[model samples]
Target: MDHKKVMIFLLSSMLFISSSGSITAGESSEKIKAKLENIDYGDITLKDSAKVKPSFNLQEVSSNETKQNFYDERIPKVNLESGAVISQKNKQIEIPFTQPLDSTDEALYSHDLVIKQLGLANTPTLIPVMEYTTRVEGNQIIITFLVDYTDEYSVQVKDPYFIRSNGNLATPSDVYITTKNAPVNVDSPKVSLESGTVIPQINKEIEIPFTQPLDSTNEALYAHDLVIKQLGLTNTPTLIPMMDYTTRVEGNKIIVTFLVNYTDVFSVQVKDPHFIRSNGNLASPSEVYITTSNTPVTIESPKVSLESGTRITQSNKEIEIPFKQPLDSTDEALYAHDLVIKQLGLINTPTLIPMVEYTTRVEGNKIIVTFLVDYTDEYAVQVRDALFIRSNGIPAIQSEFYTTTKNDQLIVD
Candidate 1:
């Protein structure tokens, strides 16, 4: 009887545990099915009876459902200090702040900055900080942002201006920085070379054109500020002997003249910011091409002739020669080396006339050569090869010839 009772009690305990498990599982399954009904499983459609199979495990259905967007509220936020504004000068604006930025701030090249014309309907210009630099002085960080524009501006800085040490995006204080109005007349000086200028190989001079007249006192500083270079040459060109080159200002132009030793294609460039205009604007350096050839352009061979008479006038010590081009008048020393005077018709040896002093002046195509002869000779005189004419410092070409022959005679009286 005791064995029978023990078996019946064990059977009763097992029946109660099985029923409790079934009730809990049924409740869990009902909850899971209710949650799945609200979820749109993409393209698949199902009804209440098809909610779940009777033998399906509730854990499998709960594990397979996907969560599309889950937000975690633990991300760090941006921090923008107060009192940040902008200052203006011409087209450039400066962002000023009372509190120094972090040493590792990305403000230099940050793309989150926006500048806009406040009054206009124009779209805000997204100006990435293209040019900027940062320096640390004591506990402060100094940064300069270089921005250019044509009108007034209002600056805007978005969130996450910099990344914090804790991996949080820190933004500058949200503020509208209104810049002052830009100046209208303050423009950079402009320079250009006149076209159709024929550069000579020997004596080269050009008048540089300017948008504004240069300061007279500062014009003298540009005597050496202009640099001359040969274009196609591999090596530096040998500049002609450095004479007293004249640099002067006439109206809105600067005239520069220098001696060139060799002839080839050349270029002229302004050296630095030393060139200044009357309006206090510095001249922007520029380069211009100058084509050069070895052939002389403005010079024609000088024509040498003698006054006709059986007896040459001895009293007239001057010999006059006419040229097809005007002579260079600025040449201070126009003497015997330029005009070689040699007497002809010598039996033993030709007697070259010693030129003591000479004067040359160009009147249109005529060059009056006034020769003050020291010694008197009765031989026929003639001029030598081409003379360097001085209207614009161009050398005149000439065919060499001694005017007087062996039979030719002259009375030096």
Candidate 2:
């Protein structure tokens, strides 16, 4: 055999034996100890000599490995109702959760897997607390949750929403009234005159001024009638004659006037002015007089009689009597006496009584006549003439008288 071939074979055999021994040694306690020494349990303060209990049991270790797989399978199966899938291929799918992933272990693993596959955090994740149920129907997911997390989180991020509608805010229009111009000041006196008096008829047109500028078209602003309200006078609402005026504008004022009638003076009594006496006598004229300061005033009788008769005295005034004759009576003489008293303006009418007795005797061709009167009362009697003689031959007359009663009730001749 050649020495070079022998050297190659021996080197190959040695290399094979060394490799087998290394494999067996790697599976031994020495390798296990080395691995355990290099691991840090995090914040364990035990000294090198201290006896530390192993936190990991072989059974638990095995179960933990199984639980890791269990968590991965169960978490995805949770359906994360409030989330959606961004990408998927074959049996694997990438879902975009509504919120950040929360589980510590799962989040780390999912992050690594997602970064490796998607090359970014684009595989959206959610907190374990946010996982909910969703029903997939066609391209849409009917998501439902025990708690609504979207709205709860949005309140912290955005403003509230509102709606707009018609007739929300409005304003109204304005209305007003206007008037015309008229004369402000004018003086007019109301006068009453007697009938049959001739008066001056002035037809001159006067212009009345108004206080404020007025629209003449507005009749309400114009004077419909001359309203003369008597302030100091006792009577009210005196009606004055209506006069039309021509309107003229001088600066800002108006002036108005009317032509009044004038008449001549005449004298007449305003009242009956006289009275009648009870016994057909007249009172003194001074008792029935009246005078006025105004001239051209008409005086008319009241057309009625007072209790006294008319009697004019030296005082230049008519006086009243106690009685007057009745105007309406069935007695002709009484009515005639009344007419006479009225014509004379006497206060009363005289009362007439019948002549009671007449005495006649013939004495030597001469006739002597005696007259007597009877009054109802003794005080009413008055003897004027007792006797009168008529001579037949010469047509001569004679008279004589004698009184007997205290009231002169008897007469003799």
Candidate 3:
């Protein structure tokens, strides 16, 4: 603390005491009245008032506590009307206040207002109002805005102290409201079929997506007014008389299923309009055409002919006759009559060789015939369709034993 000499005309003349023209935080002038109380008038030197005329003046002052109490009473407490439904097709809402507000546009903005859009089961979404405006009249505040989407709304006011017409501050407020539906719903339902859509197999599903919730369930839509062109034969699609296909509703989509055929194609549309939105709006009509995949071809039995990288060599003692499929049995008795070993006869005709030393066994798809013959001997082997049956019971195509085989130049490749 800096100590200095204070010249007072009298000991009781505290009103004339010199101040530094300021007070510290949380300080009051009344607290300093006792600082001069202990001093006696006899010890202080008196100055001649006539000779020392004061060259300065003091400003009027009052206690801070008294001023604070008076100011608090003048601050107007504000109240806003609740449950006010928004009016007018135009995008604007009127807020009714309890007292008249300041005429300036800045006073309206002093209360930081926030608008939020509410939905049935969705979280609150903020509506940014950078271009919003407000006009005050009488005791009501008309808040004009461009926010136009949302089934309901939540209006909020922050601690932005607004000033009243009498220079008193208006307290902050909060409000909740439900507004009329938007003039036009941009989220109108839309639906379409996937292009080039086809059911690849039976018991498969084709999902059709919708932009918004459907008005009714799948059963109601199908039974009331729904046109579905069921798949028919190739180039002869027949729209079934009855609704044999199954359908279910999942979220914002419809799942459809049927006894799928390879030639099934679908043409679905809504004519009487049963697929409607929640807001009573008709779902936009879309021509959906779906085609099925081509019918798969049936395969015949594999030929028992020479394949690439494989050829009949007369030198090996065991002649491997492949059936191009797994053989059902490996017992030599099963193929005894069906197998015929032949060689070139005298007139170049096929002559059957004796089967005394020949042994036959099944190895995978090939029939291994073991014999005690020289490599130079041209032996022919035949697998008939009679006993040489496939594992699936399909008989092998008939194979002729001409030379040592059907033909010397037989190559499946």
Candidate 4:
């Protein structure tokens, strides 16, 4: 029988045996039931009575679900004893402790550990940690680096701040790292040019973005050492003098600005750039070849070759032209054949002059146009091609300045 039923039967038997009445068993049974119902079982204390406790198999049943959970699985309920233990600096370093963790896969990459920095670069320098790592054998953290900046680094743990052990962070100051001299790898210092390095125009600044700073203090020295060559097919190598350029290092880029104006293919490179890292490491001399875009030449307007350069009091059949830059004297002949002198008729229709004779000459920055015949009525002139070449060998943009003028009246149309 069950415990409850057995107890009730034994109690009833004792009651029947103790009865001093000359009564039947069936009558005694009914009286026992009524007496048992009247008994106050709620007043009993089972824990207090040793005798009752041994007789019944009484145990408490509960449904108090799960006890506790972790906020971050990587952070275990570590024992607070001492700080961490870092070993050495190499491609990898291990921070170990004493205890079993609930997981072997550490959820560490998320923190950087606040690990004081991040991300990789191809040396020229600051050797950053590998972008992410997740290897941790219970109680020990293994960090793999992108670059072994130092051969031997003493590992340790103290703290004002970071490194995730004790379920807290140990900052760079927390973990003592002694870095030694980096091995001299010829390919150690690396760099790349930002896109669109080719300059489209002249007399503007071009920035050379570098991985590390160049010797910032030597502006004049860099300008002297660096060379800029204006490249062309047929002429000897024309060098843009250092006096016509300016160099400076601003925001990790060497900004070489042009002071003089010209348009052609040009190359810039450092002779001995003296690229220096913040830690005082020097990068070897290297060649950086970049080309500036070669664009067409250009000019200012043209007017009558008079004292006023106007046709107010018609004097001679000549035109004076001003150009953007000095003309290459050799290409002066190239400009002559391309000139189209015409007459704007009374109806504003242009009539081309079939036999026009003119001689072109470069007078300083001006081109004086002396027409051989005096055929002035309402003359207009226009270029037919990019013929006027600059001293730097770049031609002027085509068919510019369609100038018009008339005889006698105040006209330089």
lDDT per model, in order?
A: 0.45, 0.23, 0.50, 0.46
Off by over 4 Å in 4: 1-143, 146-318, 323-361, 368-402, 406-413
> Would you estimate the TM-scores of all the predictions?
0.26, 0.14, 0.27, 0.28
Candidate 3, pairs of clashing residues: 379-404, 380-404
- On the 0 to 100 scale, the lDDT of residue 333 in model 2 is 19
lDDT of 3 by residue, 3-49 (tens): 12344323224333335423222333344444434334343334432
How do the residues 90-200 of candidate 1 rate in per-residue lDDT, one tens digit apiece? 544444333334445544424545555432234356445554344433223333446544334445545644523233333454654433442223455667554434454
Model 3, residue 289: distance off in Å is 45
lDDT, candidate 4, 160-218, per-residue tens: 23235554443332433222343322222323454324434444666665665544544
- Which candidate wins on lDDT? 3
Native-referenced Cα lDDT, model 3: 0.50
- Which sequence of candidate numbers ranks them by lDDT, best first? 3, 4, 1, 2
Local error of candidate 1 at 39, Å?
13
- Please list the residue runs of candidate 3 whose C-alpha ends up more than 4 Å from where it truly belongs after superposition: 1-78, 81-89, 107-111, 120-131, 161-165, 181-413
